[model samples]
Target: MDFTPPQKRKAEESIVPMINVVFLLLIFFLMTSQITPPEPFEVTLPVSETLGDAESELTLHLSKDGDVQFEDFTGETAWMRLGGRIDPQTVVKLRVDAALPAPKLAQVMQRLSPTGAASVEIVAVQK
Candidate 1:
């Protein structure tokens, strides 16, 4: 019998389908991801030209209408009630509307004094 040159075998694996499946999985994960909205607050902070760097542990939003809200804290309580039992070592952030009266702001600060709150930082947009 005559012997001829043996043929080379081709690779058995096909990578196209595997690549497509990987891309599909990536897209599915991105679409199914959850996006949460920021907490609701009523205050409109005034702007500042020069702001300092500070880390806020708690945020208190006071609206122009005299409504006060506590954010970044767990539990529901009025501003005055909240001041009674806050950690003294944590920093407090006060975000107040630019239009709010100075007296009201002072009152709010006074209420926060009794709380063991470490220090108060005021945040506002640049005017």
Candidate 2:
């Protein structure tokens, strides 16, 4: 038997593989994720007693100041831009501020008519 005791082996565990796996998973999630578009602006919708399920491909937002916005455009120009994009057979969703006057809302509806939208749905929050 040897006089000296056997040397203890270093208990080293490699973590590089674990780190690589974590990074790969992070990249996978980032690549597969879908991001939703942000709202154009803040809006206070009117209250309604009856809620209906309505879906539309196009949306027009009306601010309390009587300004109409669609996508990145505003005012009359926005309406003109929207007219070009509207489909005759698709419904248009209108989100108007509750504080907006009725006449302003009517004006927006009138402008939409020339676009030949099949229908218009006014969006309102349930009471």
Candidate 3:
């Protein structure tokens, strides 16, 4: 039987285009993703040049009306009903309206300060 060698199949093309497309998609997503800024409450905060030194792993906010809110890692509301996940081992940032009465603020601060909280910083909103 006369058999010519079966025609050799063309070698597979390189996947570089597919890889590039994937990388481009990844970069596009990274750039296009929306980033939420910090929430705005009604009261204005006092500014401090030294405030630049204030850093926190978690943030708690006390509104002027005596309402409390918490911020999660994504900087979104931690949900008062669901409560918050605070690690006592780390510093929790406390933001209070400048107008809130000191005793109320102190009580709130005491409640916030648990064994794991590394430190407490009372932050005032900037006007």
Candidate 4:
């Protein structure tokens, strides 16, 4: 009887195909994902049953306490600063907190009117 050592078996399956598939899935998700810019402040947007498309280069944020915040400015000063920089025909996107009262909303609109903006679009989440 011969006492021979068993030959080592080689791996029959290669993991290269599995790795390629995983990489392909990763690339697919990266391409399909939508990335939104982070807001300067937290805001609770109002919900709407109907959706509308409103796009603008300028955005104004309103807080629950009736305080308006803009790029590096807050309150009345923010509006003033925006008024000078924004064009008269530009559309302003107003992102106001849902908790804000109607009067406050009117006040903001009143203030915005002087800027000569063509229109103000209130941003809201569609339900």
TM-score, one value per model:
0.61, 0.77, 0.55, 0.69
lDDT of 4 by residue, 46-68 (tens): 99999798899788999888888
Best model number under TM-score: 2
What TM-score does prediction 1 earn? 0.61
After superposing candidate 2, which stretches have Cα over 4 Å from the reference? Answer: 1-25
Clashes of 3: 5
Model 1 misses residue 77 by how many Å?
1.7
Q: Residues 4-122, candidate 2, lDDT per residue (tens digit)? A: 98899999999999999999999999999987577777889999999997798688998898888888888878888888888878799998999999998888888788889999999
Question: Poorest 10 consecutive residues of model 4 by lDDT?
Answer: 34-43
- TM-score of model 4 relative to the true fold? 0.69
Cα RMSDs of all predictions? 6.8, 2.7, 8.9, 3.6
Worst 10 residues of 3 by lDDT: 73-82
TM-score order of candidates, top first? 2, 4, 1, 3
In candidate 1, which residue pairs clash?
A: 46-125, 47-125, 47-126, 47-127, 48-125, 48-126, 88-116
Q: Supply the global lDDT for candidate 1.
A: 0.75
Tens-place lDDT per residue, model 1, 1-127, is: 7699789898899999999999999999999998644755656677888786557756777877667777544334766556754786878877788889999989888878878788888886655
What tens digits encode model 3's per-residue C-alpha lDDT throughout 64-127? Answer: 7767766432123444321345555577777777778889887776665543566777775443
lDDT scores for all predictions?
Answer: 0.75, 0.88, 0.66, 0.88
